[model samples]
Target: MRERDIVGREGRFIAEGKVVLNVLLANPAFALESLLVLENRLAGLTGQIKLCPADVPVYCVARDVMDTIAGFPMHRGILAVGRRNDRRSSEELILAMPDKALAVVLCGISNHDNMGSIFRNAAAFEADAVLIDETSCDPLYRKAIRVSVGAALKVPFAREGSIEAIVTRLQSAGFEMFALTPSGMTSIHDAKPARRTALLLGTEGEGLPKSLLENLQTFKIPMSANFDSLNVATASGIALSRFSRFSGF
Candidate 1:
């Protein structure tokens, strides 16, 4: 299928590769609309194909045909169409969180790679959910899903409202909001997270809005004097790892 055929399908997305296809099939949060495989690679995918529901259709095509259809070489030789089973609002997602929770909140994160990596880290740290503002790119974007190694399919997230509004809602829900930045007042190692904690991150370069840092409790990862900041994704991993239940903090 062409790029236009897969993207902007309205609640639908294209997932590629065996790993991502497996994630799509296994997760009940997303429904598989259809699967496409390279004919030569079909034998190796029997186990995954069996995992699909009886109603889901699977199509196998020759390599040349597949390449022509995709408008590029199908190196991984796997692709599937998936749709979110439920699109929850930010309020609904927040209300559903357990009392003691760790969440990653993002603002204006337009880079797909960074978005994907953040989700992967969130999953690794066992975060409860990810809250993103409207300006951020879709976590379900094809490259984001692939870069996340399917973690995007596993993490629960909702995109809505302005960054300030999102932070306010989480704050009202008993979350201790921390705007992560280079000039934070408290060191990440020293700050004690509350029962419900949210780590706020912003796009690279500009970082979190100055107004947010002024209002919320802020924390920073200590670094060498020569370096001032970490990439948004890297910073998230460090912060989430510190606050995650597994950290024994």
Candidate 2:
């Protein structure tokens, strides 16, 4: 696809909709397919793109410029901003799932790469859902979806507010809430999740907030001496592997 189909083209041409600055940068292949959702005609694009088959929002910018407004840059190129994706509700997501299924509950994680990795790991492990707290980065944001290698586009996800409410709902639905932290005495190997589990991973720098820590079940990934912790993405990958069991034990 041409660059205009990816992000906005130039002046006089608006973005397809209210897409964030980054997601457009993430997936350059997103474009009008049917009604709402976007379709990727080109393969091997970084993931950061999404669309619905029902939304009718559209606009046109006449041309593309290698550098239009900011006359100078490290690289010159045209850009297109995609439409904003609709966020699903937690109830809708739960109802959409089968019983005793697994989903990833991303806590206050902020880094785009970590968000992307979490989605990739979710897809890799066959988790049922990927839920993000209100404060977390938008997984649909171009870089995240791109970094997630389009796993963000493939996985069923919901962006919600109030981590407490979402967690409570998950708990009520019988999800085992395991908070991934370095401080926990029980390692992931010992904690061992079941068929129905909610892996709650925290942020990049400060880790889980004290408020969330107070309520959820917490644990750490046991590492070699002197090594404090792994990058949030790496740790999630390692933790995800442990969920692998003998003949689906």
Please tell me which predicted candidate would have the highest TM-score against the true structure.
1
Q: Return the lDDT, model 1, position 4.
A: 56
Weakest 10 consecutive residues of candidate 2 by summed lDDT: 35-44
Each candidate structure's TM-score, on Cα atoms with residue i matched to residue i, is 0.96, 0.68
lDDT of candidates 1 onward, in order = 0.89, 0.62
After the best TM-score superposition of candidate 1, give how far the Cα of residue 21 lies from its true spot, in angstroms: 1.4
- Native-to-model Cα distance after best TM-score fit, residue 133 in candidate 1, in Å: 0.3
* TM-score of candidate 1 to 2 decimals: 0.96
Runs with alpha carbons beyond 4 Å of true place in candidate 1: none
The list of candidate 2 runs beyond 4 A from truth reads: 1-86, 244-247
Model 2 Cα lDDT, one tens digit per residue, 1-249: 333344333211112222322333344334333222122211212232334324523222222322233233303122333443434588678667777677788877888778988888887877778888888877765457657766765677887877788888888888888888888758787776766778888886788788888877888888887866789988878777776332254
Q: Tell me the RMSD of model 1 versus the true structure.
A: 1.3
